[model samples]
Target: MVERRILIIDDEADIREVAQLSLEISNDWEVLTASSGKEGLKMAVAHRPDAILLDVMMPDMDGPTTWENLQQDPTTKDIPVIFLTAKVQAAEQRRYAQLGITAVLTKPFDPLTLADHIVQTLKWV
Candidate 1:
């Protein structure tokens, strides 16, 4: 199996920790984390993880804006991103679908199955 490198950007400490542990243990993924979007942007540029799990709601910079910043940069634009969000309303889903992201994974995700969900969503082998 190709070991995936994943970067998780979430404002919540618990969310970041749980996701890092989940990806690391479940899929043997190399997990890097950042607590905010600004830090996440720097990490994304420097580390260049295979994929980024981005939290949709953050104080300084929200996920869509962060994704846009990622897109504008040549170095990180092509990396696939999955948005982790709690806004599951139809309007929110439609808006996310319009963002051209690979997938939208919900918040309060199952720790055990997160790797599987990501693998399935991204078609990672």
Candidate 2:
């Protein structure tokens, strides 16, 4: 079976490291990471990973805005995005849904189950 690639876009180095280690160790996945939206966009355009795990809050461009930009570009629009965030308020989730975001995982997540959550949300076998 071919392994799927995952791009993680987060401003927090610690979170990116933890997620990379956890996902790479737990599944047959190739992980790429970026510390900011700009770098992430570059990597996304260059590599076109199977999926993206984007952080909702960042310095210059937030996840939703980044997602919009990705959608605008034909190269990255088809890639699935799962937002990883600390905010779990009902109103916030509703807003994300309104923005066409269907998958989200709250921060401080269990690294062991994170990959599983993503796969299930994306309906990947």
Per residue, candidate 2 scores C-alpha lDDT tens digits across 1-125 of: 35889999999999999999998998968999999999999999999999999999999999999999998999999999989999999998998888877588899899999888988898887
Our model 2 lands, by Cα RMSD against the true structure, at 0.9
C-alpha RMSD by candidate, in order? 0.7, 0.9
Assess the local accuracy of residue 57 in candidate 2 as a C-alpha lDDT between 0 and 100: 96
lDDT for model 1, on a 0 to 1 scale? Answer: 0.93
Return the lDDT, model 1, position 99.
85
Cα TM-score of candidate 2: 0.96
lDDT of 1 by residue, 1-125 (tens): 78989999999999999999998988888999999999999999999999999999999899999999999999999999999999889898888889888888998999999999999988886
Q: Best-fitting candidate, measured by TM-score?
A: 1
**121, model 1: CA deviation in Å?**
0.7
Q: Identify the runs in model 2 with alpha carbons over 4 angstroms from their true place.
A: none
